[model samples]
Target: MNETLSLFGLATTPLELLSFVLSVVTVWLNIRQNHWAWLFAILSSGLYGGVFFDAKLYGDMGLQLVFITVSVWGWYQWLHGDDTHERLPVTQLTARGRAVAALAWLGAFAVLAWFLRSFTDTDVPYADGFLTAGSLVGQVLLSRKRLENWHVWIAVDVLYVGLYLHKGLLLTAVLYAMFVVMAAIGLRAWRRSMGQHGQASATMVLK
Candidate 1:
């Protein structure tokens, strides 16, 4: 089979096409709060691992491995992290929590950027490391049911779109572009969930 085909003047490969479809489904499921999203996340991350590797985006390749680990943890947490087997509910982080998460992302970017620059031949080390660190922080927030995760994803996806375009991964660039839109939708949906839950809890207290 041909590895690359011209799709509206972009490189579209079978593998990238598969990854794109799975990634879209995964995010849509995530917005709907379906644990099945984690399963698809695992699959998409595995495929993206190869996709990024072929593009010499080593940081992203490593990030995919981390994503798989996080997805498994997220799968279990979403299924059983509540009082029993109930699904996890979205909640906002405190100001301090947000600060701490931001600190962690900055710290990770510094470390990973140094490592990639010192040891790897990656061209866009800073951008790659920045996105990788942002993704790590976002995944951690997401697994813990934080509403701020979508914000992190929205930011990361924008950078990723540009980085992939620079690296000549047109399909992956398009994928991240879609991710940015979906992350915005997810932010709106999760905020709605949190608002409704808070109202319900208040009513229970009144009762």
Candidate 2:
């Protein structure tokens, strides 16, 4: 029997099962606009870092470190990173912000892919780099409470599901599949919030 498949009733690695639970909780909390999710994010990232390291997915392993930092930054952002020291509202990316995010994603992909290609013997460097880069963009957007973050997550998590499957991380693949669904749900919920806010602003203007 595979030890990795000996954990929960679902039969996954201990780290995988734990990370899966933490990540799911993190996403669900985020969907409800809760800041506590970041704490879980940090823990999940740490566990996944070890899992990816053992799996020889060096790029993803490095990404887990980045995720730890991003989770910390996000925690602060949700609590007091607002310009007015108040809770930040769901917002849209500015046109310039969109451009910058695009450039950042491209640059991250190029640099990480090159580094993985030159320094690591990992076979999925490009795929790993691509997903890692996308995660960076998604994490930043999420930290800022940008509504579009869910879209980024949906796109990347789908690819992640496939990649984890290819890498034989069955549990991680299942988690990413659920991430895709959660991202979609988050997008819809956030869109409703945006609409409600818009209506409120228009009503205020009329009054």
- Per-candidate Cα lDDT values, in order, are 0.92, 0.88
Residue 156 displacement in candidate 2 (angstroms): 0.5
**lDDT, model 2, position 35:** 92
* Error in Å for residue 12 of model 2: 2.7
lDDT per residue (tens digit) for residues 174-198 in model 2: 8999999999999999888888878
Query: What is the Cα-based lDDT of residue 44 in candidate 2?
Result: 87
- Number of residue pairs clashing in candidate 1, backbone atoms closer than 3 angstroms, sequence gap of 3 or more or interchain: 0
lDDT of 2 at 144: 90
| TM-scores for all predictions | 0.96, 0.92
Residue 140 CA error for candidate 2 (Å)?
0.5
Candidate 1 regions exceeding 4 Å error are: 83-85
TM-score, cand. 2: 0.92
TM-score of 1: 0.96
Clashing pairs in 2: none
